[model samples]
Target: MLQSLSIRDIVLIEALDLDFGAGLSVLTGETGAGKSILLDSMGLALGNRADSGLVRQGMEKAQVTATFDAPDPASKLAVYLADNDIEIEPGEPLIIKRSVKADGGSRAFINDQPCSAALLREAGNRLIEIHGQHDDRGLINPRGHRALLDTYAGSDPAKVRQAFEGWQSAKVALEQAIADQEAAEQDREFLEHSVAELSKFAPQPGEEQELALERATMMKGEKLTGDLEAIRAAFDGSNGGLASLRAAARRLDRIGEDHPLLAEALGALDRAVIEAGEAEELLNKAADALMFDPQRLDDMETRLFELRALARKHRVEPETLAKLLTDMETRLAAISDGGRSLKTLEAGLAEAKSSYIAAAEMLRLKRQKAAKALDKAVAGELKPLKLDAARFETLIEPLDELRWGGNGMDRIEFLISTNPGAPLAPLGKIASGGELSRFILALKVALAEEGGAGTIIFDEVDRGVGGAVAAAIGERLAKLSKAAQLLVVTHSPQVASKGDAHFLINKSIAGTVSRTDVAALDGEGRRQEIARMLSGADVTDEARAQADRLLEGV
Candidate 1:
């Protein structure tokens, strides 16, 4: 609830501070007493449009501040503040301030932290609702009717929202699957051809490197074959080293043991002959090993070149060709079975849509039931407000499938007929300004504790009515105060007597200056104010007695 309001340099109000309490508080005064100025100052604090003319004549700027008790921690307003990174402490007050310059520029703040006027407006909306003859926001707007109806019905929208989201998700998945299948069909021939080519090549890991090395070794061995043959001839002919060594050794053996020197020489010649023969045999074996058919070299070159060509075609090194083949084969398999998967996805989407429809239907039923009850309740209030012939209706219209939303498939609006035998039309189209205010009040009274702002202010809600009608309005306002704080601006003495607190707005003029002041009324002061309201400028004893009776009646 609003705790206090302060104003400075705003039109006729030049520096005023007023504290508010819970329940119904009444503000009363004669015409031109600055009661409208007080409400304008509040509108400024609540982020209403700023005008340079609202500033006092001699002041450069006008400012207003409103303080409210902290709302529930789990409330939407609290969550919105947290989302915007505005931190508020527990049990601390929520202070909103606005300043408008003479140039029509304005600045806004919440809890002393600068914020945009839009943010201030959003926060203010959750804290208080101002209802007047010309007001078009809140309950009067058709866009908000469904939420209000849902609140009154105590219907939770979470199930419908969840089902709707699931349906959307399923639809998206099915669409993506269809697109993928179409694309795969276009690439089917290419995938099949590539897979077959890779399968036939049968490329092996490291095959290219191994073939290159073997070819090189064979070429080097071919170059060394001539040298190996020449070495073999030196050891093989009759006059070669091996033959000469063998002949010398035989002569030495014939004169064996004649002298120690001859014996040593013969032994060395025989070893030389044996070693030369062994060397010739090893040389022949290496020459034979180096021999290779020319066609074998051609085959190796052909294989290596083919492998390189395939690697370049696929934009991969030869070693990775094997893995690429496996991937392409898997894609081919998916393409072959795409029809089955697409059918599965379609079925899932159908199931999700069915679930959403069921949930929406249940929600619509709940709203319809609540609407009937609401109409009856509002009907009960109409007669007391002097609109007995008027009829209230909750119109529930179904939306097209293309326009369906998370809130459900229905559009709800409040309709009314102010005269008997007249067709029902929208509330705004059918009701006069005074009638509209009373209709809104009746609707509000019917709504009761279901939904509303933390504080509700009605500007002259008792306008154009008197006697029992005025008393009936007061009775309902008092009843509303039990659930939320209420402030009424009225001239009705009965309404004034119903307030938990009373404030008197008065205008004073001194020389060239005129100022407005607000004073809280006590026991005698309240009685005097009520008597003044009853008897105009002059307060009569009879009016005082009536005021006494009115006060006692409460």
Candidate 2:
């Protein structure tokens, strides 16, 4: 509920602080007593648009602050405040302040934390609902009609909406799958050809590296084999080189048995001959090792070139060819099996759609029943508000095709006929200003408990109404206050008498500055104010007696 409102330098209101309470509270004063200014100040605190003209003549800026008490610690407003990085002290009122400068620069704050005007408006919406003669008529907007009906119905349309969305999603998925399958079918021949070609090639992992190594070895062997052969030829030198040298060394050794120096020379020559024989054996073994088959080298080079050609044709690296072949094989396999899978998906989509239709049909039936009850309830309220000859109806029309939306398939609207035999029309299209305000009151009364906890302020709901009808309007407002906090700005004595609290708005001039002042009334003060509302600029004994009776009745 709105706990208090503070205004500073806003038009006629130089400075004012008004505390509010639960139940119905009425603000009444003479004409031009700045009642509109008060409401506008409240609107500013609720994040309405600001203008430099709203500032007082001598003031540099205008400011309005509103405070509200949350119904719970975890209310939606609390969560919203936290989400916007606005701090709220535990068990403390939520304070919102808006200031406008003479230059039209404006700023908004939540709990003293600077914030955007948009965020302030959203937060305000969660705490209070303001309905003026013109603003209350907004209830006739068709866009909000469905939601209002849903609230009155107390039915959870979200379940049906979720079902419809699920069905739509399934249908989309099935359609996409069918389109893909058709495209794949068109390319079946090409896929088969590619798969067969890759299979025939039968590439292996690391095969290119192995083949390159073999080719390199074979190319080096061609040069190495010739060198080995030359070494073997040299070791097998002409004219018995090693054999003659060994025979000479033996003869010298037998002679040199008596000569030590000659014996040493012969020994050295024998060692050289032995070394030559070992060199010949090593050359023969090396030549055999370098004698690789030329055909083997040719086969390796051919395999390596074939692999490289395939890599280029497929636009893949040689190492990636194996993985690519695997992928192609998988794609071909999917194409072969896709027809069956597509059919399965189609069937599943059909089932989901059927489920959604069943749920939506059930929801539509319930809404129809709810709409009838709501019509009867609202109709009951019209007669006392002097609309006895009028007819109120809640029209529910089921859409021909299912609509995937946050709400259900049925469109709900509030239709009314002001006179007997008159054709019913949409509320906004036909209802007059007075009729719209009464209709809003009826709806609010019908959905009082269901409406979220908040302060409801009605600015002149009694407009175009007076006498007994105005009294009836006051009775209804008082009834509504029992369930939700209500504030009414009015000139009707009948309404003022019903208030749990009364405030008088009056204007005064102080030191060349004009200011609007608000005074809360007690018992006698409340009576005098109500009397003034009854008699208009003059209080009479009869008006006081009437005001007393109205208060007693309240």
Candidate 3:
């Protein structure tokens, strides 16, 4: 609900403040009493187009601020605010403000955060609705018709959506699988030959490096083996220097036992014998380790060449041949087992399709039932609003295949025939303004509990209506206010009499400047205003008595 509005230097409103309340608040005034000024100021805050003309003649800028009561924790407006990351303190009012400069530029803000007019407009849409003779811009957008119908029918649309998405996913999966199977079948012969070739070779990971190392060692060993043998012979052969040294050491060991100098010579001979023994062992090991074969070298080199060639043919490193083998085998297996896998996918898709069809059919049936009830309810409101000749229908025609959607295969549109034998067409195409307002009224009454903005404003729902018809409009407005605040600008005293709060808009001149001010009427003031409305520029005693009678009934 809009709690307050402040306007500064806007057109004829120099500075003004107004407070609103829940329920039906009526603004009544003589013609051209700055009623349009009030609407314009509110439009600024609601993100309507702004220009230099909107600023007062002597002022540089015009500003308007509107404050709204915080939305319920679970309301759509609250959800919208949260989703947009709009900062709001705990229990803070939702404040929207707009400023227009003489230069024809404007700025908008929400909760004091600088924002764009589009965002402001969206937020305003969630909080308020302004309807007039030429406007049914709130509940009649046609997009909300289906959702409102579902709400009226009390059906679970979410479940239907889930079923639809499940079927769609299954369908996509089936198509992808069929495509893959076709591709694999096209390459079946190639896959078979590749798998066979790789199987025969059975190349192992890291084998290329192992084979190359062996090849290098064998090739090098053949060139170095002779040199290694000469070293071994020098240490252990009988005609080598080691043999002469050993003979001299043995002779010294036998005769040097009696003297310290001879003891030292014996120890030195022992050390030399030990050193030679160690060298002989190492030399034997080295000579044996050089066992080489040119044939083995050729075999290893040839095998390595084959691995490298295969790797290049497959566009992979030699180390990855093992992985390629596994993948090719899997592809072959899939090709062999394609029919069974495709059958499984098709079966799943069929089950999902069946579930979706069932849900959509149920929704269709329920909507049909709901549509009939809505038509009857709206028809009942017709005669009182002087629309007895109009006929309302909910058109639920099947959509074409290309237009099918998750909501169902039905295109729901509200159609009206304003005269007997006239073809039914979309409401916007067939109904007059008064007829539309009545139709909208009946819809609001039917969907009063379905939920909408916390406030709804009507420029003149009673247009072209009078007497009991006008009273009925007032009654419905009051009834709607139970769910949300309602403000009406009306000329019917009967309608004005129904207001929970009444305001009178009047204009006056201060020197050469024109100014407009809205006055909240009390009991006496309301009586005088209603009397003035009942009469013409005069509050006759009879009009006052009639006004009292009207207020008393309310």
Candidate 4:
């Protein structure tokens, strides 16, 4: 509930601070007592458009601060605050302040933290709702009627929203699949030809490096084979070093018995012959290794060139050609099996849509039932507000499929007919200003205890009614206050009498300046004020008695 409102330099209100509490609080005074100014200041704090004229004469700026009790942890307002990263403790106050410059510009703050006017308005909306004779926003907006009805019915839209998300997800998947299938069909021939070519060539990883090394070796061998043969001839026959070393070894062996030095020389010669023979064997192996077919080099060169050309065509390294082939084949397989996948996606989409429709249909039935109950409740409130001939209806119309949403497939509107046989129309269209105020009251009364702001302010809801009608309006306001706080600005004594707290607005002229002030009424003060309301600037004994009786009734 709204805890307090402090206004400074706002029009005639130079400096005024008002504390409010839970229950119906009434503000009453004579005409031009700055009641409208009070409401304007509150509106400014709630992020309404600022006017330079609202700043008091000779003042640099005007500021208004409105404080509200902390919202329930699970309430929408608390959720909004959390989502905006505004931290508030469990028992903390929600303070919204707005300052208007003389130049028509303004700034907003919540909990003394700077914020945009839009954010201030959003936060303000969750804390308080102001309804006036000409109000067309807030609950009056038809766009919010469906949500309001849902709240009244205690229907949860979460199931519908979840179903809607599922349906949309399925739809998107199916659409993407269809697009992929269409694109693949257009490139079917190219895919088939590429896959067949890659399959036949059968490129392997590292094959390019091996082929390049073999080609180079073969080219070098073609140039060096003759030189290799000349080297082999030197190691081949009896004239070679191996045969010569063996003849020397045999001659040395015959002389070895004649001297110790000669025996040592023979042993060394034999070791030399063995080493020379091993060298000849290695040379023969080299000559054989140098031999290769000329046509084999041609085949290897052709293969290397083909691999390079294919690599350039596919925009990949030659080593990755094998992986690329596997990928292309996979795509081709998808195209071949696309029909089955598409069918599965389509079926899933259908099921999702069916679930959404079922959820929406169930919500629609709940709304219909809620609408009837609401219409009957409003009808009961109409007669006592002096609109006995008025007919209220909660019109539930079906929306087209394209317009359907998480709110379900229904468009709900609050329609009314002011007179018998008159066509039911929008409240703004068919009802007069006073009648509209009463209609709003009736609707509000019927919606008592339904979800709404913690505090609701009404400006002269009983403006065109008196006696029993005013009393009835006051009764309903009191009843509403049981569920939420209410602040009413009224001229009706009957309505004022019903307030748990009553305030009187007074205008005074001091020197050349006009000022407006509010005074909380005590028992005698309230009686005198009520008497004044009854007698119009006079406080007669009979009026006092009537005021006493009215007070007693409460």
Candidate 5:
């Protein structure tokens, strides 16, 4: 419920602060008393559009703030505030403020944190709904009619919505699978041919690298083999260099003991001869190990080239050919099994769609039942509001095809015929402004609890009606207040008298500035105000007595 509203420099409102209470509160005054200005200031605080003209003549800017007291802090609006990074002060009212500058710049804030006007509007929508005489006619909108029906039904339409979403997902998957299978079927023969060719090739992992390494080894040693053979022949020949070195070493060792100095020289020569013999033997073994057949090298090179050419033809790296082979094999397997999978998916999709249809049908039936009850309830309200002969009906038209996530394929609208024997039409098309206002009030009274908590502001909904009809409207507004806060701006004394709290909006001039002043009235003050409404700028004793009676009844 709206707790308070503060306005500064907004048009005729120079500086004003008004506190609101729960239950029905009505604002009343004569024409040109700034009633509209008060409403506009409230609208601005509720995130309505702003204009530079709204600023007072001497002021640089205009600001309006609205505060609400939520019964539950975890309400939808509270959650939205948290999601938008707005601070939530503990035990404090939810404050929304809007400011417009003389230069046309505008800013909005939620809990003192700056926010976009769009965000403020969204938040305000959750907190309050202001319906004027012209605005209350929206109850006839087809889009809103279905929602009212569902709310009346008290069923979770979310179940049907979820089923629809699941059905859509299944359909999309089935379609994609069918498309893939069809494309695969078109290339069935080509896929078969490729599978057969690649199977014969049988590309092995790391085979290319192994073949290249073998070819390299064989090619590098092929010419070296002849030179190694020549070296081996020289070392193994009888009386070759090794044999001569051995004989020289023996001769040197035998004479070494004859003389001390000469012995040292002979020892060193024998060591050198022995080392030369060992070198020759090592060279002979190395040469034998290096030998390879030229034909083997040519064969290895041919096999490596074959692998490289296959890699190029397949448009893959030599190493990646193996993975390509595996992928092709998997594709072939899928092609072989695709027909069976397609059948399974088709059956699953059919089952999901069937479930959705069943749920939707059930929901549609429930909505139909709910619609009848709502029509009867609203019709009962019309008589007291002076539409005793009018007929209200709920028209439920089921669409030909089911729309996923919609309200169960039913396009529900409220239809009304204002006079007896009149042709029924869409409520908005048939009902006059006054009739629409009453209709909306009837619906609001019918669905009072289901619409959630918020301050409901009825802006002159009693327009074009008077006497008992206006009194009935006031009664219903008072009844609505039991569930949520109710605020009415009205010219009717009947409605004004029913208010738990009364405010008078009047224009005043102070120091060459025109300002709108709102004052909460009590006792005699409220009686005088109601009497003024009853007598139009004059308060008579009879009107005051009538106001007192109305207040007592309320």
Candidate 6:
């Protein structure tokens, strides 16, 4: 609830600070007593648009501050403040201040921390709802009807919202998968043929270098074989040194026993013969290895050419062809399995849709029951507010499939008929301004404990009807106060009499300046104020007696 409001240099109000209490408080005065100015001051603090004209003459700026007793720690105000990085202690006062400059600029603050006007508006809306000539915060707007109805029905709609989101996610995934499969399908045949070709080629890493070395050796094999064989023959052939060496070694051995000198020469000749035999063996091995065939070299060259050609055709390095084959095979496998994957996602979507439907159905049924009770309750209030023939209803109907949302499939509207035989219609077409004010009061009374701002300001809610109707309006306002604070601006004496606190709005002129002043009335002050409200321009003994009776009842 609004704990206090302070205004400075705002139009007729120079400086004023008013403390408010719980339950209903009434502000009363004659015409042009600055009652509207008081409300304007409050609106400014709540982030309403401001202009330079609102600043008092000669004043640099106009300021208004509204302080509220903190809402529950879990309230929307707390959430909004947290989201904006504004910290406040629990149970502390939530202060919102707005300043309008003479230059057509404005600033806002929440809890003394500088912030945007939008944030102040957000926090302001959670603290107080002003229902005036414009029903901006009322149920006339269709957007809020569902949440308000949900609050009255006492059902959890978040579960259905969550289910709907899950269903949407599944649908999105299925669509993306289908698109991917369609793109892959365009290249299916090419992928299959490529995979098959690569599998057959079976390219190996480092195979190119090995093949090149072998081709070089085979291409020059004829020349190398000839050179090697000639060298072998020089050492191993009978016409070569091996046969000669054997003949000389045998002769030396036979003569070595006849003379010591011949023996020493035979020893040297025998060593030379052994070394020549070893060299001939090595030459024979070399001669055998050098015997190459052209047909074998041709086969090797043909294989190397195939590898090079295949590498070129594939547009890949010879070593990476193996990796390409593996990747192509994997993509083909995924595409082949896409149909099954899509089916799985479709099943998930169906399950989520079913869950959402069940929850929404349950919520709609409860809302239907709540609507009936609400209509009947509001109907019960109409007769006392002088709308005895007025009909009130809660309209709930299914929306189109495409228009369905997280709120549910239901579109809720409040309809009314002011006279008998009148067709029930929307709030705008139902009645006059006075009738609408009474209707708003009835609705407020009925949804007294529902989710809403902590403070409700009814701007002349008892505007039309009088006598018993005014009293009934006052009674209902009092009833609403049991759950939340209320600020009622009214000229009705009955309504004014019902307030826990009464404030008199008066205009005073000091020389060239006229200012509006608000004073909380005491006993005699209350009597005089009530008497003035009862009898305009004069207060008589009879009006005082009536006012006394009213106060005595309170």
Provide the lDDT at 333 for model 5.
81
True-vs-predicted CA distance for residue 206, candidate 3, Å: 1.3
lDDT of 4 at 410: 85
Best by lDDT: 1
lDDT of each: 0.90, 0.83, 0.85, 0.89, 0.81, 0.85
* Clashing residue pair totals per candidate (backbone < 3 A): 0, 0, 0, 0, 1, 0
For model 3, residues 102-181, the per-residue Cα lDDT tens digits are 98899988888988888888888888888766774665667767877888888877877899899999999999999999
What residue pairs clash in candidate 5, if any at all? 12-516
Q: Please name the candidate that would achieve the greatest TM-score relative to the true structure.
A: 3
Model 1, range 297-371, lDDT digits (tens) per residue? 889889889889989998999888888889889878888899899889999999999999999999999999999
For each candidate, what TM-score against the reference? 0.84, 0.86, 0.93, 0.92, 0.89, 0.82
Question: Model 2 reaches what TM-score against the true structure?
Answer: 0.86
Cand. 4 Cα-lDDT? 0.89
Q: What's the C-alpha lDDT at position 20 in model 4? A: 93
lDDT of 5: 0.81
1-554: candidate 2 lDDT, tens digit per residue: 88889999989987889999989999998888899999888878887888788999978999998888844657777888888788888888788889999987999988778999899878777777887766733466787777777776677777877887787888898889788778887878877887788788888888888888877777877978777766666646555566677778878878987889888888888889889788767767666655677888878888889899989988898888888889877767878889888889888888887888788777777778878888888888999999898888888877667454547667778899998999989886676777877888887887787775488888888888899999999999999999999999987888888899999999887898777899999999998888887887779999899889989998
What TM-score does candidate 1 get on C-alpha atoms? 0.84
Q: Which residue segments of model 3 deviate by more than 4 Å?
A: 241-253, 256-266, 287-291, 510-512
TM-score leaderboard ranking? 3, 4, 5, 2, 1, 6
Candidate 3 local lDDT, residue 133: 64
Residue lDDT tens for model 5, 98-150? 99999998999887799998898888878887777566324656877777788
Error of 2 at 85 (Å): 4.3
> What would the per-residue lDDT of candidate 6 be over residues 64-111, giving only the tens digit for each residue?
988888767787789879889998888888888889999889988888
